[model samples]
Structure formats: C-alpha cells, structure tokens
Target: MSGSGSIITVLDMFGARLPGDLAFSLSQCGSISADHPLAGEIAAALGGKAASLPYPRRQDFMWVTLAPTAEQLRCVIEDLRCWVLPSFGWESSPPIVSDGGPAGRMGALLLAQSPQGYFRWHSRPADTDHVIARLATMRAVIAQAPARLSQLRPTLEMLRRQFTLGLATGDRDMALQAIDEIDQRQLDTASNALSMSIRVAAAFGDDQAIVDHPQLDNLLSMRVPQRVIESVLLAHHAVFLADLEAAGDIKAALAAYLPLHDRLSGLAGHPADDADTGIVRMAAYDAALAEDARRLHLLADRFAGDTVVAALVASPPPIAPLPILEPAGQPAPETEAQSVEPAFGEPLQPSVAELETVRVAPVAVTAEPALPLGWSDVPALVATSAREPLAALLQHAALMPDACDPGDGDFLIELLTDSEIIADTKKRAQADQVLTTVIDAYVCEERFPRRERLGLYETVLDIWSSSRALSTDPIDGQLLLTMADALLRLNGHLEAAVATMITRWWEARPVRSRLAWLGEALELLTEQSSAQDYLGLWYAGAGLINVDHEGFSVADRYLWYRLGRRLGLDGTATDEALGVDWLPLHSADDPLLAAGFRKIAIVSLHERAAREAAAQIEDRTQAHVVLVTDHAAGEGTASAATADVILFVWGAAKHAVYRAFDKVRDRLEYVQGTGSASIVRALERRVRAAGG
Candidate 1:
C-alpha cells in the first residue's frame, strides 16, 4: 500500500486496497547519462511490461514497481538508496521527487519533522527505513544547488562588466585585472580579441618596454576590439608629438600634433550611439589635443628667429663626447699607489736640457731622398739600422691615408718601437697622434669586415708590446679601451682587448673588480655561447694582478653557472659546474665543479679554430678542386698538399685524421730506428706482405 510516514494511522481510513500498481516516481533520477545501467534497472522494477527507457526521456518522473516478495522489495529499495540518490547531489541540476501528491513532493520537510522519524515508517514494510533515510539525504542536495548557482553568477557577471568598462574608459589596470579573472575562470570562451588589445596598450605606455617590443604592428593586425583600435591610432600620434617636444624640436612637434588634433576632431563628429559614452570621451580627448597643439605652435613661434633652431634644421646633431665611467667597483679616486708611472721605462725626473729639447709638436724634416723601402722592408730595416728605419717609416706614414691598411699598420709599429723616435718626445707625440687618427678611422668605417678589423687591433697591440716604454699615454690608453668597448658592442672580437690589457696595460690598469669586468664581458655574448670561454682568459689576466682575485671566489663560480643556466644548459657536471650556489664560497673547492668549469672554457678556442677553417675554405674561388686535410696545423706535409687550402678538420664527421697518422708514424719510426738492416728489410717485407 502507498503510505506517507507522517499519517500512518490515517492511511487505512482513506481505503486500503491490494497493491495493483506498486510504483513511485523520482524526478531527480533524470541527471544520469543515457547509457548508465541504473536506467534499465528502474524500468524493470516498475513492471515486466514496462519498456526500456533512456535517461531524462522517462527518468525525469521515473516510476518503478515494487515486487511481491519482501526480498525483491528490499532489492528495489537498496538500488535507490545506494545509486540514484547520491547522483543527484553531484549533478549540476537540482532534484525533486514527482507524480506523488504535492504533500509527497515536500518529502524532505515531512522527514525532518522529527530527526529520528525513520521509526515512523517501520510499520509499513520490510526495510522501509533504508528508503526513507536515502530520500531525506537527496532532498538536502537539491536545496543547496540553487544557493551555489546564485553565488557564482554575480562574480562572473562582475568580471565581464569590468572588462567592458575598462575598454570603454581606456583603463589599462582595470582591463588587465578583468583579463586575468576571465582567464582564471575560463570565461573568455569565444574570443580573446579585447584581452590582446589591452596588453598592447599597457606595453606601449611604458617607454623602456616599448623600445624592444617588435610586435606592435603584429598586435594591431590581430582581431582586436574596434574601440581599442581607435584609441591606439590616436595614441600613436600623441606619442610622436611628445617625443619631438622632448627633443626641443618645436617645428617637428607642431607638425606631429596638428594632424593628431585633426584626427581627434574628426572622431568627435561621428558619435558612436546615443547610449554610447564614446562621444563624451572624444570631446575630452579633443580638448586635450587642442591644448597640446596650441602649446607646440606657441613654442614654434617663440623660437622662430633663434639661431640654434636654424642650425639644427640644417644639419644633424654633432657627436657627443665619450663619457668616462669610473673604473668598475672603485668608489675612491686613484691614490699614490694606483697612479701611473713615467713613460719610456724611465724615472719621473726629467733634466732641464731634456725638457727644453723635447718638442711636443712635429718638426720639419729636410728631404734626404734615400732608396724607398716597401711596407715589408720596414721590419727588415728595423733589424739593421733602427734609428734610420723608424724615421723612414714615420716619413712614409705621413704620406699614407688616415685609415691605414695592414701595410701602413706594419710601418706604424716600427715607428712606435724605434728608440730614437721615442727618445725625441715631439716625434713620439706625433706618432701617438697618428696612432689616434688610425684608431678613429677604424671606428668610423661602418663597412669594415670583422676579420680585417680584428687583424688591425692585433697588429697595433703587437707593435705597442714591442716598445721598451710599454706605458701607454693616458689619452691613448683611454682611446684603446673605448675602441675595445665599441668593437665588443658590435660583436667583434674583444679577446684582442683582453690580450692587450693583460700584456701591455696590466701594470697601471685601473680595472678594480674582476666581477665588474665580467659583467661587461657578458653583454658581448648576445649571439653565441662560445664567448663564455673568454671569461677564463679574463680571469687569468685578473689573477696576475692578485693572489686571490674575484675569479677564485664561489660567487664567481655561481656567476659562471648562472650564465650557463641562461643559455639553457642542463645541470650536468660538464655543463653547469654543479649548479648555482646562492652562498659564496671562500674558494672553489669542489674538484668535479672545477673540471667542468675548465671544460666550459675550451668552447671559445674551438669555435675560433672552426671559424678560421671555414674562412679558409671560402677564400678559394679560382681553384678547380679543393682538398682539406685534418693533418694541417699550418705546418708539415699537410700544408704542402697540392690543394686549394688546408683545413685542420673536414668532412661530415669532422675527423682529425692527423692524430691517428701521428700515432702510426710514432710506432713506425720506433721500429725503423731499433731494427738492424736485415730486420728492417724483413719488416718492410712483412709490411708489403700485409698491404698486398
């Protein structure tokens, strides 16, 4: 019999009858997937005549029949208790029991009338308590679903509204926040066009960030919001005018601003919609644009007759003087201990007679008219008559171009080293001025190839090293360092500078901290990781200056590892030197780390060798055939091979066949020397026997 738990006594008065259609309908059962087994079971329990049904089609008010046996009734109640009721709590939709009276639909309310009310249903049938308890539990989940949906709806709507307002008001911060929220919630389900436009505006607003961002054009071409597109177009002209005004170019500022003002005025004419706030914003923008234009025009009129403005319009700005940065990590001025010694390897004292005779300017030389020598002949002449050789070279140098070729560079080296010329302060000063001119020419030539430029620097340093007075004039030293910094910035070989600094300029050099020099060196490694090996050479130079220099510290090791990490090297011992240590070590004590560091250092030398070999291969334009040998160390039989050029390694394998050849030769030579004539003949017979 169908019965309510609250009215067990009144159920018999209504009129009891045989259980002809023992059935109950549950609305919450609709949420199950169509393929779920529970759907078929519910249909079977209703009656044998019931047809199979899928979820939600008939399960929304699914009615199931109770079997006649108590065991069968228990089985039907158990399925509802274990499977169907729990599913309703997890489903996104709310659940409710149906097809009973309106009073039965309020089943959870009737069950809650007494907390221990399950005993009220015990008189009805076997295991009825289990069914009552499950129904009550399912009712609780249905009640909570509506409350959860209410909370989520408002937050999502607020974020969407904030994003829309941000676009309308041109507020980058608010727009970014909305974008972040939308991403976190996965609410921007359709298009990210508005989000992308906001990011572009934020990037463009920052002067420093925009300088290197090459994607402004790409962003503009994307499917961004129309309002964002309009704003950016106006902002571009505003930025240009602001830049010109900052540079003191009043005419250019006026030219850039007036067009911007016209664009804004044109926009204000086409009001977006009556409800749209864009028209009001355009009016505000118009006012701002007009003010900027008026200010720029006024400034242009005020400077109308200024001579500086007239001169600026005619030509570009003059080159600014190179600013001298204080030696890295050195806060204090140079002390007596750090001051440079005298030039020409001599004492600070100069005699009155010496001072009088030393002319700082060049003196006129009478024409002697000796046999003219070639650039190659200067080195040979210097070996014979040193004084006459240098004087002759300087005279030849005077007739050469401002930018010296390798030949002129060779002659200049001879002049710089000539003792007689250096002894005469005027001639030494004159040669220095010539040296200055040569370096300036190197700097000014935009099209000079890297190899030729590198050779020029090496030649100059070699010449400077040859001089007995190794002390560089302060101005000349600064010029060399400046040239080095510039060459390095252009990704040119700066190892020559490192070599020059170590060999010629080390004694009186003002490089205070090796760490600071390393930081400068890292900037030059933009294109390749091969430059990292040069740091070891730098450390070697710094080591000579101190027993315990910065290179020996754990901080230096960490810096090296950090650089490797930036290159995306794995933390293998050979690559990362045992990873970065945050704490500085007193000394690099780990032997494994040290070995890996040494391995890391050899990259630069290997890269340089490979580059040179490639260059040699490229230079052979006329040769019909090219033969490269791994045996060529620029010496021995490999150099004499009748081929275009000899590379130290070749082929896809990059095989060093020379090393194997040397090993075999060593064994053959040992056998040849140790054997008697008869034994040698026997060995040669055996060698021929093996070959045949």
Candidate 2:
C-alpha cells in the first residue's frame, strides 16, 4: 500500500497514447502474473499491435523494441543490463536521454520506478570517427568462441540497424566503413547476400571505393548461402561490369572483371534450383560483350584519314619545298602571301594573284555517296536490338502491324522456350512481359481489326496452351478479358467468355474486386442497354468465392441507364448529368431508347422472392407473377394472357436467358403495360412484321 503511489506514477508514465510499441510493450507489464486472466487477453491484443500505431509508423522503433510480460517489475531491468545497456555502456552512458521533453516527462511520470526506464534528460552526438568501431571491438570477443558466440548473432543484427541509420543519415563513408568492419571482423565465411547486393548497388558512383577495396569480389565469390542469391549476384555483377566498361577505363576495367565474367559464364549450365525459377536470360547482353574486343579494335583502326591522304598527294609537305618547274620558257613561283601590285588603284588580293599565275586543272572524281540503312537493315541484322525500341513498339502497338515478320510471333515463342531466359525468377517475369506484349498486339482492335483478329487470338492461345503446359501469366489473362469484351460487342457468346476467363482465377478475393472495378468501368462506357450487361456482371463476379452486394447495384445502374428516358434517366437527364456524350444514345444510330414505347412485351425472369419483393412495384407496373422457370405453358410458368408482366426466371446461369429465348414468346406480343417486358416484346414484333 505504501508503494501504491509509486506504482500509480509508473502507470501514468504509459499515459493515454504510448509513443511507440516499445514504450507500450514496456508499459502493459509489471507485477501481473502470467496465469492471471488478463495475461492472455493483453498479449493477444499486443500481437501485431504495431500496425495500430498512429497513422504512419516510424521505422526506428521496429527493431530494439522492449516486450516484457506483466509479471515482473525488473524483467525489463534484467533485459536492459543484459542486451541494451552493456553494449551501450549504460553504467556510464545509456542508449537514450529524456531531457523532460514530452516523451521524457511522460516516460518519467509513468516509469517512476528508477533504473528500468531511467534516462538522462539530455545528451550530445557521438565523437567517434567510426560508428562501427564499437562493433569492431565486440567482434573480437564473439570470435573467441567463449560460449557467448550464440549471443553474437543478435548483437551483430544491432550493428545492421546502425548501418541502416547510417544509410538514412546519408553517411556513405560511415556505411562503407561499417560494412568493411563486418567483412573483416564478424563474418568469417561470406557476407549475407541481401546486404552484399545492396552494397554493390550503392557503390555504383563510387569507383574509387570499389577499386581501392576488393571486398565485392569476396562477397560475390563466397561459396555457400542460397543458389538463388548466387545466380542473382552473378547477373548483377555482369551488368555492373558491362556498364563500367562502357563508361570507365575499358582496358583496365575488363582486365579486372573478365575473370569474374568467365567464371559466371561457366556457371550458365548450373542446375535449375529454386532461385533459377524467375530468371530470364539476356542472350543479347552476352552477344554484345562478345563484340567488345572487336569494337575496341574498330575504334582504334584510324588508318590515315581521307584528309591526311589527300593533303599528302596534292600538296607539298610543310618543311619540304616545291621548287618552281620551269615550263619551257616560264617560271612557276607566285605562291607567297606577299603584296602583289596589279597596275590598279587597290592592292591585289592573294586569290587574284594566284588565279593570274597558276594553271591547275579541275578533277572530276566519280564516286557516289552511300545510302542510309532503312527498315530492311535493322530487320536483317536483328542480333542485338535496343530494349528502348521494344518498349516503344509495345507502347504504340497500334502503329506496328508488322513489328514482327509474318511468322515471327511463333519464332518469338520458340526463342523464349529455348533460351536461358528462365534461368532465374527475375528473368522468368521478363519472359512473361515479352509474351504478354505479343498477345496484347494481336488482340488490339485498331491494329489487327476484326477481319481476322479472332484467328490471331486462337493462334496465340493455341501456342500458349500447347507450350510446356504452363499456367497463363496474369497479364496474358488480360488478353482473354479484352477478347471477351470484344465478343460481347460483336454479339457473340458473352457468357462463355465470362465463364472461360473466370474459371481458374475467380477464387482470389482481391482479383474479384479488380473484376468489379472493370465491370463498373465498362457499364459507365455504355450507350444503351444490351444483353452485354450480363457479361459485365459475370466478369466482375467471376473471380470471387463470395461477392459483395455491389454487384447488384452495378446491375441496377445498367438496367436503369439502358431503359433511359422511361426510367427518367436519358435525354435531358443524361445531359444534366454528363455535359455531352460524343455518341449520344438518342442519336440516329440508336432510336430504340429515344422512343420509350408503352407496348412491346418479353418474358422477364427473376426468382419468386424477387417478384414478391417487387410486390409494391405491382401497383405501378402491370406485371403477372410468373413462378421461376415457367416459360412455354410449363407447370412453373404463368399463362400468357391479359396485359401483364411475362416474368421469365433466369437462375444462376445468366446465359440461360439467351438459351431459353425460343420459349420467351412463340411470336412477339404487344405487351401493353409497364416494365421492360412490354417494350422489349413490342419492338421484336415490330421488327419481325416489318421484314420487307
């Protein structure tokens, strides 16, 4: 009871909102037994409680956080003495300072318990040149193998956090020094692949650092870790070496790097392990490097330029004089820039004097200028095409109908299959991109058009489905989506389109959301109601195990928009909503929606519950309740008598509507009543009767 005030102060230090998880973790602790009722509840809430931090999470608190059970007051103190403080020299200097700031005061007010949450009010930055010097000192102790080496792993991890801090502070020299210390002191085998890769990339601009230290060679050449890491490292080094050769001292650079390249090239046939799954090979990079020595030779093959040779043959050498040749009776020496007087008022120019004396004849050299290489040249020599052009070709595919030759799509597929492009996971993804571009081109409307574009789709799909029996890449699936979209517009099998694309992929929930968004995008792009709306709904709903109520709303919006003015949504209604539509639904192109007729009836299908739910609509709409699936005088169907709604029940299969079209009405009826059936039925009858 006497210490209640002190405990109260400790609790107060935690406050309403903990500054960080470490602070919070340290707070929900103290004197509460593990078997207590609150223990399970508290720990469960703490799991991933870092996610519930205020809005944006600070990265600093991710590591070095303190998590203590509520049972012990000094559990944190024991932890402080063992892990946090000893390395930090907490006996003399703690890891943190308080200074009575908001955090400091709050911490003090809560942790009124001394020692465990103690901190100095203020402090200054480190005076050491190497932030890692402390780590370098500790590495010696850990390497001694004094039974404390197991503790070495976590301590070194703390060193990694410090390295990240160095990165954040933009301290390159400190970062480099720290890495050098790790390689030199702690790691006897090889540096971690992820850490080493980051260092190599970071050293891109720092040639002096790379050349002065061959630590990269050690990092890359290390024997064992993960094969994926090894393959990735090899590729990364190959790219870096190629870049440096282009921009730096080619001779010196290649001499230092050729050995590495040869070693990596020798590893080309290394068995496909887990890491090799995503790799895509770049044969062009290999081919380009093969020409490096030849290119160097070509650049240096400056064998006496045309200007030098022409000067040698036509003019005398600078020091060697050309004596005047006496032409029988005349001397031929009027070649100095001296003033020569012609008996005129002005001094004669050098050109005038030279023309008067020299009798040189004109020479006509018969030579034609070279014509530049056009499309034929590039297509012929397609050995090493630039990646930039490929990007452009894919981006503006509309312009590139002949991007590949007539049978070249097949050639590309074969090339992908045969090459080491899938040598690793990274490159495997690239292969997918290459394949997707080809598919996107063939499926595009403006590029291929409808004349035979569907044939292209069949060809590509055949090639894909037949090859290696691999699953279609997600991007390639988009090709099917586009085709489905087109088939719907062409009045082809929209339901089949939906079913085929959705069959394998609809199981993922997020994929369903994407489909839903796409459907909404399509509906908002419509002119009037068509059966295509069903495809859109099916497409959006295709990828979900469980769908949201949003699908119903999408269907409702489309139905209302399709019905238009009768539903009070088209004509002036649309104009009030959208400023202008380029192809207005009420235009000469489409007059169906323009005239909302009262006649015309077709069978509308919905569940029995739906009819009962629209019961209030019965007062306003003249609809006869037809039990579901009751078309053509069947037991479940309603009689086609009186002006009432011919409700046709469409079950889960949206395509059943089209399949059951024959039973909808033997001939169209002038459905003189409310709802979609009346207008639809009347229009069909009008079209059939006016068949002139």
Candidate 3:
C-alpha cells in the first residue's frame, strides 16, 4: 500500500480473512502479519496454505496464517527469500530475514498493523541488515506512518535502532550520521547520542574523530547520569590506548595514562548506581573495558622496570575510614575519636588569635537535638582547629549559609590551605569541593554581603597564587577561571593571579586544550576591560605563536583578533603586535598594494570596526572606501553595487544583508573577522591571488 490509510485497510482486510481464534492465537504469540504479493510461493515453501483477501474497490492481496513449523519458517525465510514473522509459539528465537529489499516495506506494513509488534520485531538482530540496507525505505515508511504510530512511538526509537545496528555492523559513518540526525532533531537523547558516537569512533579506531567530536565536552558539562559519564571516559581511555599503540611510545603513554588510571581506579571502587538499580547491562561496554584493562596490564608488564608502572600494577593502598565527629557541648563517648597523624607534620594547636576571630552568636536551647557540626557548632569547629573532622564535615555537609559572615569565610580558607589537608589527594579533592561549595553559596547565589564576597574573592586569589601555581591541570585551571570570572563580574578587575595563570597555561604548550582555556580567558578579559596592556599580553603569548604548530588553528586566530579589536586596538597596532607589518603592506610601490581596489565597500554590524577597516584599506592602497552600515539604506546598497570590491564581514554582518548583496557576490570578498587588520589581510590575499 502506498499510503498509511490504504495500508491500514489492507491490514484490516487481511485480518478479516483470518478466523477469530487464529487472530487471537497470533496476537498471543506476538506475531505480526504483512500482505505479500508472492504469498503463495511463501506458503508453498512452508508447506502451508494461502488465501486471497478481497478489498472493496482495491487490488486483492494474498495472506497466510503466521503459524508454521520452525523448519518450515527457516526454509521460507532463508531459501524462498520471503518475510516470515517469528514462530507462532516461540518469542525468543527471532527469524533472520534476508535483506531482499522488501523486508523494510513489510516492516512498514507490520508497523501499521501493530506498532508494538513492529518495535519488538526490530529490537532483535533479525532486522539489523535490513534496516541498514533499506534505510531510505524505512525512513520514508516512518515519515508517512499514521498519526497514531507517530504519537505513540516517535522517531527517536527508530534512530536509536539504526544507531545500534550501525554499531553492530561496525559502520562508523552510518552510526555517526544517525547521531548527527539525532542532534539536529534536538532529541532528548543528547547524552545517549554523544556516548554512542564516541563508542563508534573508538571502535572504528578513529582516534582523531573522538578527540574532535564537538559534543564530547557538551556531554561532560551536562548533569548526566554516572553510568553515561563513566562510559564516555572509558571510551576516551580506549582512544588513548589506540594512539599509544599507533605511536609505539611506552614512556609517553604511561605518563598520560597515570592520571586517567588514578581517576578511573577511584571510580571503580565506587560503582555507579546503575549496578544496583538493575539497569540493562552494556555488554559492548563491559567487553571494551575488559579488553582495555588487559592491554593496560600487558603494557605495564612490558614496562615493569619503570617505577610508575610497577607501583600501578601493585596492590592499591588501603584507604583509612573516616571517624565521626561530635557537636560542641555534646557529651563525649567513653572512647575518644581516634585521630590520624597529619600527613604534613605534627598538628598545630589552635592559636588564641584564631579562636578570637570566630564570632559566636547566642543560641536558644530547643527540645530537639541538633545534628553534629550544625550551624551553632561551626564556631567551635573553627576555634578548636578540629581540622580532620572539619574537613570531613565540609565534604559531606551542605555548606549553604544563612548569612554572609567573615568568620565562615576565614575558616573555609584556612581549611583549604591547610598543609595537612593538601597533602592527601582525597583530602585535597575534598578541599576543592569545599571551595566550589563556598563559591556557589557566596558568589553565585548573590545573597551574601558584597564586602564579604569581595573578601572571599581575594582569599581565593591568594590560595591560587600560593598553592595552585605549579598545577597545570586543566580542571584546576577551569575552576580558577570560573572564580576569576566571578571576581570580574563583581569588581570589574582581572586579578594578576589569573593573568599569571593564563600565561603559565599558554606557555605550557600551544595545544588545543590550552588554547581553549586562553580563548575563555580572553573573552573574560575583553568583557571586563579594554586595557591594551592586558590584552596585548595574550596577543603576544597566543596570537604570536607559530602557525605551523598543531593547535593554533585559523579559528583561534580569528577569535584573537576579534577580541583584540574589541579591546580598542586598531589595524596598525594589532598588525605591529604580531609583526604583520613586515609584510608588503608597508611598501607603497608593491604590486599587491598598487593592484588593490580603487573603491571598496565594507559591510559590518560593528560601526567603529567597519570605519577602521575602511581607513586601513584607504591608507594601505590609496583607494576610496565606502562604509555599508545598514542593509536597507539605499546609499549603502548603491555603494556596495558599484564598488570595485565588496568586503562582507561574515562574522559581524547580518545574514539578510549578505543575501541582499548577492547580486554583487562575484566581486564580494567574505571577511571572517570584524577587525581592521583582518580586513586588510583578506584584501591583500585576494589581490595577490588575482595575480597582482
């Protein structure tokens, strides 16, 4: 049937041909029917009978009962090349239908009859090859399905099925395309799509694809379930191993794997909640993890002489249990709390000055007892230097405050910077947890007093300078920048601590990760202030890096110049900063300069940038400059039409304006950035390419 209405009618006519008892039996056995033109041939293959079904004012079709012997169904499916429903009584042994091109059409008919049956049938492996081979037919069928089928089960399930089939067949391109469609449709399966795409890329040994996939970070930034995040990270580790094997570099790979190994080990100790929730087991995921672990152990054995690998494969260190702490003024138990010795050195007793700094407010005694280390007990914890239990409390406790108090801020900073706390990795993580919690409460919530918040910002800066200087960890850098952004929003000042951190991160390497962080830092700096000295520091550090390097991409340059212009630098200054003036732009008699346009039109949304670009062009080539500030302005349109060259600032111009200038597109040069130097650079390239 061509349309869904006709397909439904055909299904109804076929049902009418079946006896009520037979129909009920077929329904009970979870069998779906499709009217086939060669139903007689299929019946002969199965040694069954076929009946002709009559339809009012439509072509008659042949139908057969779903009940058939297992051997007969196998013969009909494999030999006769006909679609056969799963055996009438058995639901587990799904028949493997050949990809004879009619299977998808038959699936469409079955879908019209029973959508649930359609899904159940496709969920098995029988439909995998058929789904891939007749993908276009299946798509059309789904698109033209009845509204009932569309409403009950949307296209998301179909997309997931295709993705699953692609993975099963090792069709990486197909799987990635399915994921892209899911993203384009704005489906709610964003996390699932991202995880699937990563696994697909890793399975196909496309390590670069996994690294360059745009949604990887987006998925990480989401509040995804623990299982999903773990799966993504495991896939990342697999990519790392693949790269390592390809390079044949054991030492470098070991160095990269240690941090990831530590992180994964920590996660492995605490399995995700999915294990206990009885969710469906991911067999592929488990198999991949096991394989990766085996490979890792092999690598470790090969490099057993190396100390790090030896220590890694060795038995893990035992983790000490955390002791419970009692609130202030509570009666102590017969046994005292056992305190472990600080890792740094002997524990220092609380000073009198530190005790005096904690302000204790009056509290009313209530009938119900308060929890340990509650609000009232904070002052005591701060005053007594109860570092160990206080660190535990901060880790597990909700740090939301009722008021902005300098006393709470001081105690948190003290706990975070405590040498004893920073010595252990777990405790250091807990300290970071406390820092983020305080930031969320004091900075993000904005319920705290401004003066107190500023004081906390300064304390954070001091902590970063003193303790985090040597850390090149991207996660730590992100957290630092987050705090810096918060501080900038409050006081409109970029702390020198942040500036130094950015410089250090950039100089560490010109890798993509570092460049991404620099881009974020540049955005923040540009937003807060247009100080040339501050902006020039980044330009010198990042913008001046060798283009031959792997990480300094064209997109990165565009961003740097765009932000530089936003910081009040003109074409000449920006060009000089990057030594671009050494080019032929300074020579008036240069052929490229002489061959430049007599009249050029620049279109942009940023008026000052547009004017500056125009000035730069006129100064370099002695050409007349026309500024197109508005798309609808007649004078702008007229100037754009007659100009010898039209420079459309692609990043800063509206799409409607670009379209309006389509009549002059032949002479139009698409400029990527709104900066004056970018425009001049583009013009020079165009002239040179035109045989100037």
Q: How many clashing residue pairs appear in each of the predictions shown? A: 1, 28, 0
Q: In angstroms, how far off is 210's CA in candidate 1?
A: 28
Q: Give a tens-digit lDDT track for model 3, residues 520-614.
A: 56655655456665665666544434222223433345556566577787877665654452222255575535785688888766576567667
RMSD of 3: 30.6
lDDT of 3 at 335: 37
Winning model by TM-score: 3
Q: Give, for candidate 3, the lowest lDDT window spanning 10 residues.
A: 276-285
**Model 2 C-alpha lDDT per residue in residues 594-618, reported as the tens digit of each score:** 2333322234332322332234223
lDDT per residue (tens digit) for residues 163-214 in model 1: 4334322233565676777777777543353434443343223322332346
User: 1 or 3: which has the higher lDDT?
Assistant: 3
- Lowest lDDT block of 10, candidate 1: 596-605
The regions of model 1 sitting more than 4 angstroms off are 1-408, 441-458, 461-515, 518-692
Return the TM-score for candidate 2, rounded to 2 decimals. 0.22
Better-scoring candidate (lDDT), 1 or 2: 1
TM-score of each: 0.22, 0.22, 0.29
